[model samples]
Target: MNPYFCVMPFFGAELSSNSNKITPCCLLKNNSNIDEIRQKMLDHQQPVECSVCWNLEQKNIKSDRQYKNEAFDFYLNKDIKSIEEDCKKGLYSEQIIKIYTSNLCNSTCVTCDSYSSSAWSSLKGIKEKKSIISISALAQLDYSNIKMLSFVGGEPLYEKINFDILNYLIKAGNTNCFISIVTNGSVKLNPDQLNILKKFQNLNICLSIDGIGKRFEYIRYPLKWDLLLKNIELFKSLNINLSVSYTISNLNLLYYSETIDWFNKQNLPYNHNIVKYPLHFSINSLPKEFKSLLSIEAKHLLRKHLPQDDAQFVFFVKELGLQDNLKNISIKDYMPEMYDLIQKNI
Candidate 1:
């Protein structure tokens, strides 16, 4: 057996050890030769499955098979030793570590699955629970394997605790570690805070903005569009790498092109993703024209940045059409009850 194969369950291989049978998915053919599988796995250059894999798994059995295969290939070619070496160096590891700082957010966005009054109520008593990990614990972590440190939350910038943690990491002299923050861009980082972040050469900010002007403000309620724009400008002026992430939903589906055009005008890298409504909601109820617009935009974007990504974009467009008569109107004109459902989960 190849050394990489020693790590069983490569990507999507469902092995029923009791029966000694292997069910090959997209990553592996039903009767694929060992050499072919190994080569394909090597191409992925990583060990773990990403968000794409998770999204695919939630779809049909066919997608699960494809996801498994992709995962298997990723692990097969990952350089375990190199990752170990980087971690041991204690400077910067190639692996990405997402630290959930806190669940508190200032925004009451309708589509946010993490921000409800009840959710805030649940957190009230948990103050004594110590959700904030100690700085010493972070310093003692095995960084040799980590390539990036992502601070995610309901909103990381809302709390000082999250900033403190980030400050500690930067001071630790792990300059090689890439730091990423996923934020709503509502909170402004003061000059001192900005200076600390600037010390880390690899710091990147991903701002979540669903639409433009009133459309964005309506979906992400309690947030001012101008405030977000100001913060974005500040980040850009500081030479910080900034990206915009738009979560496509029924509320802003019609403004897909407008959203893209707006982000492009800002000269920021932007990505649009569909809202994965939880299991309770009917996927068939979503708007078809909205999905179609996203598919078209995705295809156009991929042509310039990721030629290979076009296939997946096409897949989603087709998936939307497969469902029964979902309304075909642009969502910008009307709000759906599904927005409330999303808020509850947030």
Candidate 2:
């Protein structure tokens, strides 16, 4: 087996939209000096900070780094050694910049908190100042061989700085690089923004919708269902390859069929990203016996509806088993529909 060497740093850098912290992936957050970080990347040493991928890899599961390796090969079309040599020196060369800094989201998703969403701060009585990654800050980075830049939010479209970055790239004539914007699909891009967005080498929009109809409104609280559907239709109308990011929790896991049917009808591709934070709202919070039953049922659904995802079935069970504590929430009060489904399954 090949050693776990992730060459992303040779070509990528993920930034905290709210802070100056930078790391290889969102799963790992580190405070090491930039020099040390670069050296570690060049060494191909799997640091402790990348435990998220490491854990998944230990279980023989594909990780973000694996996908990124394939992506690097396709996008850069350069040997890893050449990139490593550059990193070996103090100089930094970044191609993929995945930023999540704008705290200016309008909706307060049940799965997100104050740290990630400014709207959550106001709703929950926590206070936070809005932050933006100014063009000057980004300019400091070497964008010589840039291939992709991603903006994730609160909601990227809601912040003006995100638009500014788009304009910077377009004006700089860096239109051959891909741009990905992760949003709640509640906001629409204006004509001017859309015109420039279309100029990007490839513009991919990842819609973060947890459920549909009332279920969606509940999970992504304060969401306008009609507006969301309309927004999605607008992107699809452009023949854009829309991707769905479903954050599964016990609250909506039983509604698997509803989500599956919705995706099939729209012909939208999706991946399940189980919510493990705010433990009270996670599937791992369910009683072990309850989780066991859910595990069986979830696998059955996958087998019937998504046979290619046998590994995903194991993920659901393994993640639940790894969770140490269980703190039940008021599921019935929050989602009577899903609540009743669980009751029936009982």
Candidate 1 per-residue lDDT, tens place, 230-311, comes to 9888887888888766676544554567777888887877654555453112122233332343445443322132332334
Which numbered prediction scores highest in TM-score against the true structure? 2
Off by over 4 Å in 1: 1-94, 113-140, 143-145, 279-284, 287-346
lDDT on C-alpha atoms for all candidate structures: 0.51, 0.65
On a 0 to 1 TM-score scale, where does candidate 2 land against the true structure? 0.76
**Shift of residue 250 alpha carbon in model 2, Å:** 3.5
Candidate 2 residue pairs in backbone clash: 17-100, 17-101, 18-101
For each candidate in turn, the TM-score is 0.57, 0.76
For model 2, residues 30-79, the per-residue Cα lDDT tens digits are 56454454566556666776665776566555566776666665666665
* Candidate 1: residue 191 Cα off by (Å): 2.9
- Superposed on all Cα atoms, the candidates' RMSDs to the truth, in angstroms, are 12.1, 7.3
